[model samples]
Target: MTATQFRCLLACLPDPLTARVVRLQRYVLVSLDCTGCQEVGVLLKLALLSARAGDLPAAETVLHLAERTLRALAGHDHTFAPPRITRLHRPRPRPARSAAAPSPGPALAGQVARWTGTRPLVAATDASWKRGHGGMGFLTTDGRWGIGDWKVGPQDPTGPSKIIITELRAVQLLLSTVEARVEMTVLIDSLPALSYLWRWQSGDVSALPPGYEAPHLRLLARRVADRPRLRFQHVKGHSGHLLNEAADSLAAIARRRAPGFDVEARASDLVDSFLTSWNQQISA
Candidate 1:
């Protein structure tokens, strides 16, 4: 479907979850193939597009499938050729300063009233694309665990293998599942991912410069952010942490499943982060 029709059709769905995914099937995943970064581009676009259309549920479904498919193919020795970026349809490159965009999650109250037990289970995650690496987590200020996702891959720029594409897919998994809700802070190591999410959640897509993934990032946030409590924070990368390690492993595990549908919470300790978004929406 054309972008205009896709957006209009989604506006008619009503339910944030259902409309979001249906739009993904129509605009993002439907045209995606087993090729290169186009899949990544489509996945990223699916996310922001979902946000714009306010169909987060459907967006989450598509995001999960995209991430799973990307990781499943990550180990192959062959470099899957991707489509070239045509001047007619290319997006602006990400700014170098975007990397320095600090996360505001750390500034949060840090005293999540739910963590009265004294120990915060925090999970920090990272992902790479064309070496496009980014990370985040679900945790408490005291290092407690929660629901979150991350990945490492290449920069598709305009193709399917882009890292943000997988990140969005992972975000969908964290939000769409039945077990993802709870009170927790999600710490991400990637600035691009964090900035896009932060801006979108705050209701401002222009917060970051115009990048290919900007539109997708905004959609991803809108799809999940209307609800309060759920937050994204930036963390230092390559740090040694158990929950973070587990998230990386879980991402790969998710890929073994077909198209990332029917996926459930395997990392039970931190599924709470995922829940906060949906819960707030439900209550709203």
Candidate 2:
């Protein structure tokens, strides 16, 4: 998108904050001779820091600055390039380096908040153990987040097994702790949890493997699933998203779970998204 068109996208903002912020960014880029992608990468980080509050306008202005810098660098080569903003997985209101290590539970929540900037998000995640597996059901809302992570070790090794049971525990935590009567979205990386929500919502309780019980979530799903507002969305793991990255990093530190998520949702992704949107406009 051209600088002007990108500026127009800030219509989503509340007031003149977009203009003021954009002007600030332009001033910052006044110096610096752009060349390799290294310079663009640095500017992109500043933009991500600027976008921390979910201010789309501030983000756009920051983006416009990046674009202008790139155009100057690319010279005769296309002036308007796509924005490649990367996302970070940060705890909500990222704490100081000293507090970076949070108890697994709160640590995860903080990581999620830092990413999406939402205080509350439902999560369905599973952990693999030597015996079997464990799953967690967590909700972050209204500035407070809680989690119930349950792992099922090698047991009767029968129906439902550890994964299902652990997942059930997590789901219960979400329904029981969340006080809001309204539906909310949960971010999860587990397919089992997603299918579980779908099955319970659809009233296919029998779909669950034998010897297992959903307890409260099955009922909760029945009531909230149809609300159209309550739902869960899956974000690919290790996608370089700021919060996602932090979550994975912390999880790695905690569980030593290696072979991290594939897509590392970095700040560049956001920049890329901006550039793609910008390019579309320019080419259009």
Q: Largest lDDT belongs to which candidate?
A: 1
Q: For model 1, state the Cα shift of residue 18 in Å.
A: 10
Error of 1 at 269 (Å): 11
Q: Write the per-residue lDDT of candidate 1 for residues 1-284, one digit (tens) a residue.
A: 33433443344334654443443343242343335435644764565445433465656676676555555655421223343434432444533434344221110011234533532334344433322333322333342332222333364342543565555544543443212445545666667767667767777744533345434444546655664656777666556444444455444433332332232344333334533542355469
At residue 228, what lDDT does model 2 achieve?
55
lDDT score for candidate 2 against the true structure: 0.41
Residue runs of model 1 more than 4 Å from their true location after superposition? 1-161, 178-182, 206-216, 254-284
TM-score to native of every candidate shown: 0.38, 0.37
**Using alpha carbons, what is the TM-score of model 2?**
0.37
Model 2 per-residue lDDT at 87: 32
RMSD of 1: 16.1
